[model samples]
Target: METFLGIDYPTLWFLVVGGLFSGYAILDGFDFGAGAWHLFFKKEESRRIALNAVGPVWDGNEVWLVIGGGALFAGFPVMYASMFSAMYIPFILFLLFIILRAVSIEFRSKEEMLWWRKMWDISYSVSSIMLAFLLGVVLGNVLQGIPLGENFEYQGGPLLEFLNPYAIMVGLTTLALFMTHGAIYLLMKTEGRLFAKLTILVKRGIIFFVVIFGITTIYTLIYIPHLSDTFREDPVMFAVPLATFLCIANVPRLAMKHRYKLAFLFSALSMSFMLMLIAIELYPVLLISTIDPQYSITVYNAASSEKSLGIMLNIVAIGAPLVLAYTVFVYSTFKGKVKMDETSY
Candidate 1:
């Protein structure tokens, strides 16, 4: 049945994932850039200031991932059960890595001890590196499909499936994507040495990731066989990646001239489009299988009752705008450049 917008349940889920991924890219994108630049900010105070730029709102960005988890649990229990069970080891490790990053960010300031701060600093970067890899690998697994049995169980998993070449490529691609997003964040948020450092970082990252990502994407298409077919069959699906990379290329030149608002706008869009590409790639089917086509969880088959979706639609309609408004207000209030003296968590 059609909702108010004439969208069906399957299409509605794509919208929800789109919203969740968009929020993640906008909020977490800055964190990734700023965090990666942590090494470049030689001065302790400047590092703190760089961290402060995202302090008030970084946690809020993670809510999108939480929403993503909730969406999977509520909207597609089949994918939920299969993925969680198959990827339990890496999933648990991801939580630990994320917690370490959060703890280091919050408690680093509380401790004035040099050794303690340094220890936490390493903790932050290390955790970030591992966490980013895990996130990408998950995507890689999705693209490649795990060794699920005829019953949808990922029997050929654990270490073997996790380390497949396709998954490794996906991991690298995500690292590049997140770092690219982070670079743009740095270019827009800081001034003086910190800002310049970020610029260099951005230039290198953008050059590397944009190229690597493009190559990886092509490699994926060639290897996957059915990927281009999926895209040709659904025109909107193919456009997602093409549009995202284009924005990534265009935003920096505009930002260099202090056109930050525009840069931020495009950066947010770039990150969003990357996730949109992933969601669209997986459309109709939340999780497809190498084991069996029957195991694929399509939206219509996995979704909750029509009544449940209707209630969710109404709730999102009421609450989504307020959430968007609050995020915009926070970012705008803290707009312009941050200096070393101005650091807060």
Candidate 2:
């Protein structure tokens, strides 16, 4: 067993994969959140402003997803295969919605007809909402455990099984969180009436998210006791959830103070903290097997060869910094309110 800084290679790779997805959730999350609010703005100008808020960086934000997926496939091919096999339909729907969202954003303003723009607007909003929800559903199923049979294969079952109550609750919770995040982002990019409208929306979004999040938390505590085991064992681990709550609470506080930049930052931080909690809860186990404990795909069982992981880690060491630099540069270049020119989306 090779070690990097006293952590095993597989565990190190697990952290790497988690970090990439966390980055994706933080970056692309706002994009999805922004899109989720598309239809809320009635006027054409308002809609366009909202669209342009995320236009400059939405596609770039998706780069994290690509990198995260690739890292998962490379680092833990077995887990990737098993999870994908079990969640094929949901993943396909996710792909479809993601494509539709992209297409809607790109093509909405290309035509002059009102019907044309409306069609895309609906597509964009619905797609964004569905994308966020599906991601949560997948996470929920992963957290609960999948039916992985012998040889790490998915036990055959109806696709509708993925839509269990827990998964749906998680999905809605994810949607609410993203919507709140998006509203805060919109506040940063607009002024006057739009800003005023977004202020109200942000408040509503916060309430929506907090309510759903509270319910989801209660449900998890009541139904899925395993998720809290980590914290139960180590009292210190409670700090993560506490910090997450504080970060979430700070969003509305900063927004009320007209400090949207801080609000957005806190929203992103809250998301990161939430994912960190998930990572802590599920460390080492990539996917739990409902069929049998022994069949579960763990980091150790699912990871690639240590040599391969080592070489890839070296490559990631060089590549990740470059990606991060590029991301920072892009966001910095496009900072502040969106001013639409002829080329705007």
Candidate 3:
């Protein structure tokens, strides 16, 4: 446990992994949210506008997920192996939809045929929704923990265990949150009739997310006691959830004021704060064992050697800024409302 600054290598890697995944969630989240509204836009032009809104950065956004996965594998090989093996089914479906989503985005405009476009639109929306849901499901499972035996292996009965009520609730909440985020983005990138329509949709999205988020919070407080243990110990940590609440509340207020950019910023902040809460909750532990606490895989026990983490940290230090710069450039290049044309997605 070599220390860097005031933190150890394993803890630093944990933060790295958490930050990468949080980046993925925030960057890709709005695009997935946009795609979730694909089926709602019946007009070809509206759909195209929606697609083009995210066309420039969707693929690049996914790069975070790849980097996050690689970081996880590199930093915590044991947790990666065990968790992936336990949730193989969900991960496979996630991969399948990831491929389907990319194909849908690419192929939807290749043909002018009505049915062909319709097919891809359905594929894209469905895939995006499923991807968000599955991600939340994985997170929920991680929070709730699994039946881990000796060697930190999953000892659950079947894949069905992954879809319990709590996980499903989390999945739905994730979808709602993303949809709300997407709607706000659409609000920013549209005007006139479309903007008016999105305003109403954004209100509904706000309602949906609020109700579901409230339920998820209550459920977590009541049932998932482990997640709140840290907060319970350090009462000051309550500020995180408070900040998350204020951020979520600010989104609607800002949206009402026609401050869509600020709303989107707050939405992104809410997500980051939520993920920060998760990181705080799971600090040392990567995967909790339902069967026995002794069997849990923690950051310390699951991490690679200090030398390996040190090398990768240097690599990430150099590479992450490049990725951030690229992301900023892409968004800046395509900022403001989307205009449809032959080149449109």
Q: Which regions in candidate 3 have their CA more than 4 angstroms from the true location?
A: none
**What would the TM-score be for candidate 2 when compared with the true structure?**
0.98
Candidate with the larger TM-score of 1 and 2: 2
- lDDT by residue (1-345, candidate 2, tens digit) is 989889999999999999999999888888898888888899998999999889889999999999999999999999999989999999999999999999999999899998999999999999999999999999999999989999999996887899999999999999999999889888888887889898888899899999999999999999999899999999999999999999999988998998999999999999999999999998878899889989999999999999999999999999999999999999889888878798887
Clashing pairs in 3: none
TM-score of 1: 0.91
lDDT tens digits, residue span 1-345, model 1 = 866667886578657866776777567756865676577667886777777777777887887788778877776676788888878878999999889999999889887889999888888767776777787788787776776665567776356567677877777777776776766666666777777677677677767676777778788778986555667887776567689878887776765666666776787787777777666667777677777887766777777777877787777778778878887888788776664443565
Clashing pairs in 2: none
CA lDDT, every model vs. true structure: 0.74, 0.92, 0.92
TM-score of each: 0.91, 0.98, 0.98
Clashes of 2: 0
Model 2's lDDT to the true fold? 0.92
| lDDT per residue as tens, model 3, 179-215 | 9999998888887777888888899989999999999
